[model samples]
Target: MDPMHRMEQLVTELNQHNYQYYTMDQPQISDKEYDLLYDELVTLEQESGMVLPDSPTQRVGGELLKGFTPHRHLSSLWSLDKAQNIEQLRNWNTRVLKLVNDYNTKNPDNPLPEPGYVIELKFDGLTLNLTYTNGELVQASTRGNGTVGEGILAQVRTIKSVPLKIPYTGGTIEVQGEGIMNLSVLNRYNETAAEPLKNARNAAAGALRNLNPKTTAERRLNAYFYNVGYSDDIQFANHQEMMDFLRENRFKVNPSITYFREFDDVMEQLAAIQESRGQLDYLIDGAVIKITDLRTREALGYTDKFPRWAVAYKFEAEETTTVLNSVVWNVGRTGKVTPLARVEPVELAGVTVQNCTLNNVGDIERKNLKFALGTRVFIRRSNDVIPEILGKVTEESDGEEIVFPEQCPACGFPLEQRGAHLFCNNKLACKPQTVARISHFASRDAMDIETFSEKTAIQLYDELNVREPADLYTLQFDDLVKLERFGEKKANNLIAALEQSKDRDLASFLYSLGIPNTGKSTTRMLADHYRDLHAIMNATAEELVELPDVGGIVAESIVTFFADPFTQAAIEKMLNLGVKAQAPEAPAAVVEDSFFSGKTVVLTGTLHQLTREEATQRLEALGAKVSGSVSKKTDLVIAGEKAGSKLTKAHDLGIPTIEDEDELVRLLNQQG
Candidate 1:
């Protein structure tokens, strides 16, 4: 067969596989075989200079939408609180228990009874709202910004599971459902399409959001109705019965639905879901557990957002298989050469994955990984997180002998082994090191140069004699244009980006300085402590380390950076070029005895009273440290409605918990 014919055949097969996997829950080819065909197609297209419009390569990402328009939801849509572990689930139980106890105590004569809980798989997909009038589907909308959603009724009508008309003759009712494409369906759809979908969620989201309804219908999108948002003359006794009614009416309900009579039973059900998650045809990150009694639910009520009665207990990522093609070493900005595995692509959770980090040399040796090409390996995204190689050599053989390089690939310098890391000592001279360092300095968390990307930084270094980040401010428009692909229009854009970067706040600038271990939060702490760049530079290592979140390593890096005369001179040059390296004034004085004053708080679950941003602000204003996740260092877990895994973890770790919005408000009032 000719190359062109072979290429065409490959594309057709891959597209078919994608469609089958993504749109329909069926797959005909192994992941390894699929990857081989995909890689071949990519190579052929690159070599032949022929491009297909509907190709799988288009799914990585595309140009950002110009702007989003207001989309009023047919019913109010809300987000669920996430519980990532067993501990969070337990905390949620505890909170519910407290609420029940409190209510029972208050109304002793007409006391509410403990309610059973319903557990269902929380599909990791887009939330959609469907409106019905007189039992007929009228409109469908994406959950855009809660209050408004994009009108996609036409697109929604195409989904098989989404009924165009209700089966029951009923009054006006609003339905909430998860618009999802199964992994098998997504893969099959991608295989059959001109281009494969990136992931099931993205595929479903993109399809639902498409301008044409016919295109969405062709993808065979499906929905699992979960909730009755609003209803008149159609009431259910509990959430479980409501789901049953929905299923009885031919609405697709998540099959994993189970009922637990006790909190321990809920935990057991959650465990069962986690164990069976991998075996299921569809993807589910967590289990949604809700109170099964409607009367109890009414008493529990709601906060600003989310029902107080429900929580999602998320399962961490599970381990699976793939073929390791090769191991590549990467040098980070910190001069650590880390081992990365390039693997045959496989779908984990909902994402199509190919590469994962192997950590360091010790990790590789510890696992006794067979460094042979095409070795099957166990792979898992940590907590359904960033891809990582767990172990290797499923079927052992005389594997290809693998060895770490003694010299840096980017710069031919002798590599030094420290602990598990291989480092290039020639940090100043190495092109990759320089580019990476400069890129780090310009990152949003770092100095935050708005338009400076790794690619652009590489271009400047290679073509314009731009080595250090400081050299960026020194470049003239004429010199920028001299670089390959740097036309007049592009040059002007770069200059504009550079100009805008000068006015960034002190904390961002400090973080951008590429100090070791000084992330955005730490940088802010240091900035607040010193109040000026000069003070930070002059502070002793001990003084620097005394600040919140700053450690010995970070302090040492800051001291070293300031101690270097060359670095100081570079800063002077930057200052001369009009870079404002000063910290912004602190916000208005917070109440000294505010509710969260001096508390180290960890927020977990869905908050009704405030947004995450608002909660963080409120905590910070009251002299509290609000962390992203739960840890031993956390003083309190301010759990709102539907608290998840973090709450459970906090409970196991013996952390104090506050229940309800009113309780939290009262705590704040007392502190004040």
Candidate 2:
């Protein structure tokens, strides 16, 4: 069969199966068969250089959104207070009991007794609230800030189990639940997903919160209600009654709901839940214990951030024991060297963790870590954060002794200790440092050179002597094809991509320089301040620090980077190869400054025609302050597709909003 034909067949077949499983709750193909097809399609897409947007392999939240409407929550969704261990939980119980005692003492005529607790599994997923009116599903929203949320009603309609219309028409009803991915679904999805969702929480969050409803529909997300947030017509005596009411309505409620009269009983149930957690279809980071009586919950009231009525008992991080094979230092693009543990692969939280972070030399010494060649070690995964070594499993050491390297591994140079970080200081001499710099320079977030994978980066350096980003621009087609696995078609595509990257904007070019601590957003801020590459290169530390987000350390690094002779030569070389960054035009005198001027504005989701950089420039040009977050100080917020937590936050704060990029431009023109 022709490759493109097979790719189309696979995409069609996969989409059908995904729809059946996720949307329809009926899968025709087995998990094994789906994986085979999905993997083949991805390989073909990569080889053919024709990755379809709708392909199953391409669904990790895209450029945030190009707009979002606010959904006001019917009932306030209060965050739970957390207790990390049993001792902390006991302390919380004491405090709660004392609060009740004090209340009873004050009102002896109508004294209240100890409240019974309802124990439920705390699902590691995005919280969703669904509302039904007259037996018909009316609205759905995320737990944005508890009071108001971004309405994801369209995406909510995709969940198979969530009834569009409930059987019992008990007036206006609001159900609260978690949008979680089944462990089985997560495993299958990871096998072929372009970028794996990491865990159930992220999978659910990414699916429901994404700008694309079709993507959410394809996640097969499971929703299990825990409580009724609000009900205008139906009222329950206790939390258990609410659960019963939901189940009676054919609404999916967590079956694990249990009532406990004593604190000890709650603790016992929490232990049991922890022991049997592996049997469940989703991940639970903690167990929620809430007061069973609704009246008691109201009486207990809420703190500033959390409810006094309930507490979440956090589970310990998932960990596994493995032998530490060796410890090696890895050189980053900034030339900072950090110790990396090479451990024997051990499965922790369903993923095999072979390498874990040792943090820094101070962390290593403080923890009394000795990464002896054959020592048993403990590795842990908390939430979805990087796997970390949590001290040694045993004190005994049998193999090679752990020793800090005096010289750089890639280039023989004396390692310089600066604060906590060890630097190579080799500059042009370090092969790994140079290669990593080139790789970072060509990365998608930087120059967006899609063809420049780490493997390809190494091949360019070793095979073709392409040491720097500039060297890539000078590569000949004949020279590339001679290298193993570099087909004429692949080489031509890579060369074309490289040629196109030369015309990238100033921010991208600045970010591609691999300046330490100066990320994409920071680079844009610098670009806006300086306006051009030449101006940025000549900037002093004092001038660099004056820009937004540019701290002292970042300023020093930028200044030092440009001061280096090799860095100067590299930029000059790239410029000669037609790497263009058009200098910003002088600002026209403002005829009349609008309300947007001198205001802090936030943008969320993806923008159309305008990248975040482009939006930042246009907004800054109007004398508006573009902030990454939404706060009380924020004057306005522009929402785009799949606007997540930030957009909800903006609504909750009652800030002025712009619907889209066109509206924002109009505002700058003082027309809106």
Runs of candidate 1 exceeding 4 Å displacement:
1-117, 120-317, 370-374, 383-385, 393-398, 481-490, 586-588, 602-618, 632-672
Could you list the CA RMSD of all candidates, in the order they appear? 24.4, 24.9
Reference-based lDDT, each prediction? 0.74, 0.77
Off by over 4 Å in 2: 1-284, 287-325, 344-346, 371-379, 392-401, 584-610, 614-623, 629-671
Candidate 1 clashes: the total is 50
* TM-scores of all candidate predictions against the true structure: 0.51, 0.52
- Kindly provide the TM-score of model 2 when superposed on the true structure, using C-alpha atoms: 0.52
**Clash tally, candidates in order:** 50, 8
- lDDT per residue, candidate 1, 1-672, as tens digits? 677887778766776676445333345688899899889888988998885543554333343333344567645676677787788877877888899899999999988777788887888778888877876676778888888887776667667556554567677877888998876576567444654454566678888787755567667777788898878778887887788778665576655577878788878877766754654545577888889899888898877877788887766655577888888888777677888888899887657888887777766665556455577877766334467675564435456755888999778789999886789888777888888989988887666676678998888888878887789899899998887877899889888888888997788788777776667677777776778888888889888777766778878988998898877887878888999888766766776777677778987767776775467666787788887667656788988765656665575446778867778766655636
Candidate 2: C-alpha RMSD after superposition? 24.9
Error of 1 at 457 (Å): 1.3
Compare the candidates by lDDT and give the number of the best one: 2
> Compared with the true structure, what per-residue lDDT tens digits does model 2 show for residues 538-642?
999988777777889999999998998888998999899999965456656533376667889898888876787677766776777888877667888888875
